[model samples]
Target chain A: MIAAPRKLPAPWVLRTFVVLILLLVWEIAGRHGSQLLFSPLSKVLTSGLQIFAEAEVLEALKTTAWILVVGFVLSVAIGLVLGLTVSMSRFTYQTFLPVLLLLYAIPQITVLPLFVLYFGSGPASKVAFGVSHGMFPIAVSVIAGVQGIKPLLVTSAISMGASRWQIFRRITLPYLTPSLFTGMRLASTATLLGVLLAELYVSAGGIGHLTRRFGENFQPDKLYALIAALSLMAILINETMRMLERRYSRWL
Target chain B: MSGASSAGQALTLRLSKSQKRLSLLVKIGVLVALLAIWHLVTVDEFVSPFFLPKPDEVLRVFFNIIVTGQAWPDLKVTLFEFALAGPIAVIAGGAVGFLISLTRYGTRAFEPIVSSVYAIPIIIFYPVSVMALGIGPESKIAHGALFGFFPMCLSTIQGFSRVDPLYIRLAHSTGASKSQLFWRIMLPAAAPTILTGVRLGLMLSFLAIIGGETIASLEGIGHRIVWYAEGMQTGNMFAYIVFVIMVAVLMNTALSFLEIRRGRQ
Candidate 1:
């Protein structure tokens, strides 16, 4: 297995080459293939740029963004508080964790209608849905973070006359940071999913309406461009979370 | 020292038993409280029945739908899509993942791309599937299979890539045939992780199928809910939601049971 001596292109170069080829194929297929289903890359890109310049699409995007931000921030805040309180004592943890797991396990999509029914088709429903999706991972991870701290460290701190606050501040906080970041990364994706699902389900206004309009009207170029823009936004948010996770993971 | 430790262990065990009982009591209490609150909110029109149907009404509608067999067609469609998608995802993903794991360079080149793609919410591609496959079960199946593929591929790559080299070396020295070496040593070694991937893939495929139907399907369980909601049949909609949740929970439980049983073996 080790006998062969060979040289190969670097991984990044290979990846770039593969991507370029795929793009080329897509462009060709769009031009030559069925006009009803496919849009050329150039057309999609230009449409994407043009749509961003439109006030209507911009408003929709802004609404979506607002819901995502609000929901995620609320999730982090609520999740931290809940996780900390639950993990504060064995009784609370035992009593509450199964409930959280039960709620989490429910296929939340089933309740999309209910959410819209209660909160209407506006931002309120989307934000609520996003928080419901995002908060669980954070709370579970935070509990795990607290639980994972070595008892020996706490004992040693106690022997050195550290107060409870001091022990928690020094040991627990640092230990939790890495896992907390990991939770945030997971939460970011979940929140986006929840918000987007709500948006799409409503089909009244915002990104969902735009997509449906584009799809039904047979505007493949506009449809592809809109999806691409949303995907780019998702990637940027996900990458930021991933970077934060990596930065904090050094502690673990 | 042994006697003292044994006594301590017994005490702790007794304490744990009491704790378990207490936790169960608390759980039951919490559920009851939630149901009570829900009832209270609807009792005197504190909340609109149009928005939140009473528990009794929802239960009646649920039973009515089940008894009338209104749910059968949608249920069948959903299950059919899941069955088709699940196998497609497993075979395609497993084959590709196995091939990738055969070379370190292949694993290095593809694993990151696969994972990053997985991170993006794949629902964005639903419209594309609709465009290509139309607003039918085919699109839902395709979407589900695509969604399920990533986890299966990633886990399979991870499972095979991390197998102990020493075990392979030992098999080779024993002059085992290639097929025997793979089937006996590699397959069993990788089975647990691969099984986990399978479970995840099937679950995600099921969820994706339902989600796809919700997004743009003519008929299915998800579509039924949307239809009811648009018609403002809140009671019936609630009933459908409850039914779907039950199905999901049962599927999740059954998968977990299989995973645990196999893990024990």
Candidate 2:
């Protein structure tokens, strides 16, 4: 028998090494680089407390988080209600989905000014925008989940004299759970985009205010630190949602 | 119950024509009701009218610009950003993705890294773009290209690398040249997925340009809205919002139409 070829090391090991090389290069380059360009990774690590210790930074972080939670909760509520209502009858679906599609098609960023104009540069506007972004995906996902039930199952349930509420609770709810979780994951992403985009646009307050301040101050180390915080938040949100989605989807 | 449902279905089929008309009427009714509510709420001052200008006033501003041909210059700047960003995103993203996907080893080495970076809303680097390119159309173009590149690259890598091994092996067995195999087998198989990436990239570019302009710009459609908003020209700002929405809608419809027509071929 031929001797087995040596297997390569795991992919993650390779990935880590690649990252280390890039970071080394970045640090080396930054040592000689212009002030506007970059900060060494060493500097970024050491400056973490400088970014975290600022009270205003903490407040902005809280504001962003609070808005995201409010928007996400509202999205779940509205998406379920609206999605169910629109899918109530074939007529309603035909009447509303095309219009919904039209609304969804438009780049929502176009309306940022209107949202800011209406809600002021407050968390209210940020929450509203996040809900707007988050709700559509949830609604779309719910509609898809509701539509996915095979006709025979519905027919069988009706034949067994199931009432509307029974039909929903026993049949529809379980079927929708996986998709709902999936929608939450997507909604989380969209909501983050919307809230962050609004914050960035406002630039008068919140996390965006800090970013603009850092950039203008030409403090690349602090700028990088603050951005790294935002990136960490984004990854945490996404990973949490992904985990929940995965857990619920095992039955599916 | 199944038979009754069949009868219900037959009934719907018979009523399809009238239902279609009824659906249109319902849709129109919904729009009318929404507008009426907007008008009444503002008229009643239930909420501050500052939050929502009158619908008629917004419409008037919308038409005045169209009739007077005032929206063209702003549209030109935004579209120019689009035209510049779109090619860079497509060509560079596609090439980078293809190169990374050329070997399984490369794919394993890079795909996760690229995807994680994409997930971070690297748009946070808008300041970096602004710093590098300054507050102008060039910045928007660069911002758009950078933001748009991720989706295109990710999808292209997915598309090319995931083609069936069976197809590749069959082509090889048939004495197919590398170019022949790529052209005849890989291209067709990957076309739909790659096109999906391209479409996403296109949309992202549009959004990024608008976003970059929104954050900071001297001119562009997004800037036009900010200009009016800052100046307290609410009516005109509302009109520009509607105009931009219409443009978005039209572009998407045109894109879908093109996609369908091309898909058939």
Q: Which predicted model would earn the best TM-score?
A: 1
Query: How would the docking of model 2 be graded?
Result: acceptable
Error of 1 at A197 (Å): 0.9
Ten consecutive residues with minimal summed lDDT in candidate 2 chain A? A1-10
lDDT of 1 at B259: 74
The deviation in Å at residue A143 for candidate 1 is: 1.6
Q: Which digits, one per residue and each the tens of the lDDT, describe model 1 over residues A1-252?
A: 111236877666676787788889988998887778898898888764698888999898888888889999999998998878877766777688778878889999888888988898788999999999899889988887777767689889999999989987999899889878988998999998898888777877677667767777778888889987877777788889989988987756
Distance from true location, Cα of A35 in model 2, Å: 1.5
- Write down the C-alpha DockQ for each prediction: 0.42, 0.45
Which residue runs of candidate 2 sit more than 4 Å off their true CA positions?
A: A1-6, B1-15, B39-50
All candidates: TM-score: 0.92, 0.92
Clashing residue pairs in candidate 2 are none
At residue A68, give the lDDT of candidate 1: 86
lDDT of residue A244 for candidate 1: 91
TM-score of chain B of each: 0.91, 0.88
Question: Residue-wise lDDT of candidate 2 within A16-35, one digit each (tens)?
Answer: 99889998997898778886
